[model samples]
Target: MDVWEKCRSWTASQLQETGQDCYYQVISDTFDGTEVTFADRRIVMAASHDYLGLSADQRVREAAMAAVRRFGTSLGGSRAISGSLRLHEQLEEQLAQFLGQESAAVLPSGYQANLMLAPLLDKDDYVFSDLSNHASLDEVIRLGEAKERKFLHSNMKHLEELLTTTRAGAGKTILSDGIFSVEGDICDLPALTQLAGRHSAYVVLDSSHDLGVLGPKGAGAAEHYGVQPLLITSALSKSLASVGGVIAGPAEVIRYLRFHARTSLFTAAASPANVAAALAALEILQTEPERRQRVLNLAERLHNGLRALGYDTGASTTPVVPVLVRGRERCLRMWRKLCEAGVFTAPMTYPGVRAGREVLRVTLTAAHTDTQLERLLNAFEAVGLAEGVLPEAGPPREYAPVRITRPTMATSTARGEEP
Candidate 1:
């Protein structure tokens, strides 16, 4: 066989032998409130991103239905062509007002928005990205030939060091996630903004996990920290309980993006029903501020309870909490045990998290009751203790120590290897 055929065969063999397979266990019924039925059991969902639980709200459903009746289903063309609808315009306006921005442009997905934005900036520009940024943002930085510098996760000091040391020729931009999806730790936006300003760098904040979950009125991390960036991007899938993405920023930049961003110009716009549903969800978010507070309360409750039960939930302050299992086998075993106990959770492994740091990610929603929370806690404790995955008491031992050695300056021709 040729080299190509040999490589292909090897790839297939590797996948068959070593791939950790994931299968979608079928569900038989609709999602009602906080419960979902699969087979003969009703599992309490602790894995979804419906932070404020607006996905099943009557108002949102009604709005979606109304839009379906009026506009049918899909937008036949991209937004630049014939897909731009009145509903889109309305939602964009509402989002801009809510985010305190001059303008906003809705995209097909958060992934696409991130992928499209980095390429639009000139190649001479340098993108200072977070080391632990989401895969989508990482892909953009990698695929585009933009000069990329990764700083330690959420470390403002390291970011400033890079900014100060970088050559003046490159146009600088700092990109970070407002709320890290995995660690659940929030970015220090105030410090980041100060550094960016000092270095004359543009800032791009991705609030995909923070939107509708952080801030005073769920305006996101920017509002929480009182720092406005040059660009803000987020997804509607998580908090809005819909499907789409939005980039909110200055009007001129938005207009420029509208003309140049191929993902927005070429791909079909979001469905009419989804757009209307998101708008209604936003309306609810605006009027019912207590919903956001309730979700926060539930998150706090879960975090405290989990910590008390001797699980390692690292530095999380948002609705997303991760039970650090640290090994792939252990993480999968915990997930299977939880599933058998009628509690669904998403497990994070290998690429999603760092190697030797796999975890079981638990997300909280406002619709979940106190009883459900207690049930989840019980299941975790039972499974963790029974399987010897978690300790009975005391903090976990350090995994491994890292040693840092500074590079020493060498004189020219001292080693006699190179001039």
Candidate 2:
């Protein structure tokens, strides 16, 4: 068979390996916060991005409804045309203040936000990105047609080396995820920003998973690390419980993007309801710091429990936790077992993560209760042991002297007691 036909045949093997429809699902009872009912089977949702639980907030819902009542549903054209509204401007201003930025612009989606920001780079510019940066950013780099280099994930030395070797006068832009989605590790933003300053490079941080969940007041990884990026991009759909994206930076840059961002100029603007909902969610994020703490607390509990059970959760220090399952087939089995036991989680396979480093990404939210968390813990413990992902339940053993020459070859190096 030809290459295309051979690849097409591999689709069947993938389906058999992963079990069909692992991603697509419909939850009945839309307002349910921590748990979802699928086909009459209730499951604790551990694979969602609603970190602040603002998606089900009454105030947010009411605000959205109010917007719909006042402005109707759709904005017929792009923001630059006839789609702009008072609420859009209000949301941008509020986001700027919340994120400690000089200005902000709202877009149709987070993917679009990156897509628009990318084209700002000229032919004489170069883009440097972390290896684990989001797919959107990678796509943007390709679309922008700029010379690019990918540094090792969170490796400042590699980035610095690349910067030192680049053409002296060429403009440089660094793209990275403030909090990696699958690994759930915060970027070394302070070091990255320092390097950017030294090399005259602009840093663009994708804080989609960090905002409304990271930092003391949920100001994102930049605030958590006490560093500032040249531009910040995020998804409101994740924590703000809305259906749009935001790009925030200095006023002049935002002004330029407001006109040059073709996605913003060509696509319809975010609905008034989404803008109002995001505004409400932002207010809640500001007023209720406890909500952020709750999510973090739950995450810590889950992480500790998994560790105690001798399960490998790799380098996670945030609400998004990845249970390392190693191989694709093993991860699929673990995920299936968890789902059957009433815990829902998403699996990360090749391309989403490195080969042989598959994991189940479990996201925690403020709305998740103690009972729910305990149940999830139990499910993970049971399923992990059953699938050989963890050692058999037994007393923890003292660490043995072992050397890891290559960090990439090692698995589950996060804090743990050997079993």
Candidate 3:
């Protein structure tokens, strides 16, 4: 407790001195799909996870409105109590079918879905997880009190060694993210499944960022690899452009979780609007294949452009492109510069990635136009060269280049200097 208190104080004081928020804080006055307004300024929205841009779609909006008119706002209780609605049932059925699973259960959020499912494994069972898995998955493994081992991020050799050393007859479960949120690297599901088969382990995949963004029909990594995991969990907030979490798996497992998972049994059912919006999003995902391709194409262009500018975008083949910056100071400065350039992106520093591997996490979406992409690239080039992260684009122009500064507590007040 004393250490935690000191740590909290240290972080707060450091951020105060540096004029940094714990995470980048943007007070957006308005946002559609392509751009977000921060008070009087509009920034091209390159930091959003709304991959398919269905969040602002008229059809999805209309579906939510209709559901609200019919069912009011919420179901008013947990599903175990009075909260279960036909909409919830309908969404689950749709999800199960979409993922090619036997059944599905929708939860309040993606975090809760992992939280509820992870503890179902017995305390004596052995669980193996990737070090880079979502925090919720790690939390639930702790909650379950199961004997768990964490392998190095995506290191199959380390995983294999751990699997070999586990108690011979103990139940084994493998936990991993389908698409790592920060770095945007994909899980090698085919390789993971092969390893799971050898060890007889049940694989739990968090497809939160993959569904509606991968595979021929957007069924996610499982379909992309032509393999299925024992359990698949995802959030409806990302590509679905709605809100809620869902787990799709065997009917028996879902039935057991329906009653036993505390998060599901205690939390209120998903609101009418969210459920209906998710249903509509799912429909759009199937019908509008172009949305998926558009985002991917934009992502490729962004990735190629960043690499051309000589920025380190670690292992990403997805919409989540991370421009790696070396230290905290440079990373923060880079973020501030990009913000000044009217482009918004998320910055990852200590405890998110390793100490020195800070990155500016840029997310791409289908709604971004070619002109917007060009603007983004130009901003990156300007900032990258200014920060000495990239070489000069041309052979040294004679004119003076403008200087940008990351605001500190002492520098924050007078001119509305952005951090």
Can you give the TM-score per candidate against the true fold? 0.89, 0.90, 0.90
Top candidate, metric TM-score: 2
Please provide, for model 3 over 86-199, each residue's C-alpha lDDT reduced to its tens digit, 9 standing for 90 to 100.
Answer: 889999999998887889999889998898775567978989999888888888898786798999999999999999999878888889998898878888877787788888
Candidate 1 has its poorest 10 consecutive residues by lDDT at: 410-419
Between candidates 1 and 3, the one scoring higher on TM-score is: 3
lDDT of each structure?
0.79, 0.82, 0.82
**lDDT at residue 117 of model 2 (Cα atoms):** 80
Evaluated against the true structure, the overall lDDT of model 2 is 0.82
The reply for model 2, stretches above 4 Å from the true place, is 1-14, 17-20, 393-419
Per-residue CA lDDT of candidate 2, range 1-419, in tens? Answer: 57698667768567676544465667775434688886688889888898899898999999999999999998888879785898999999998877778899999788988887866777889999999999999998888867989999898999999999999878889899988988888888777877887788888999999998776667787776656788899999888988889999889999998888777788999999999999999999989988887887788778777777776667767777888878887887888789888898988887687888788999878898899888998898788778766666562563222111111122221211101
Model 3 TM = 0.90
Task: Give the per-residue Cα lDDT of candidate 3 at 216.
Answer: 75
Least accurate 10 contiguous residues by lDDT in model 3: 410-419
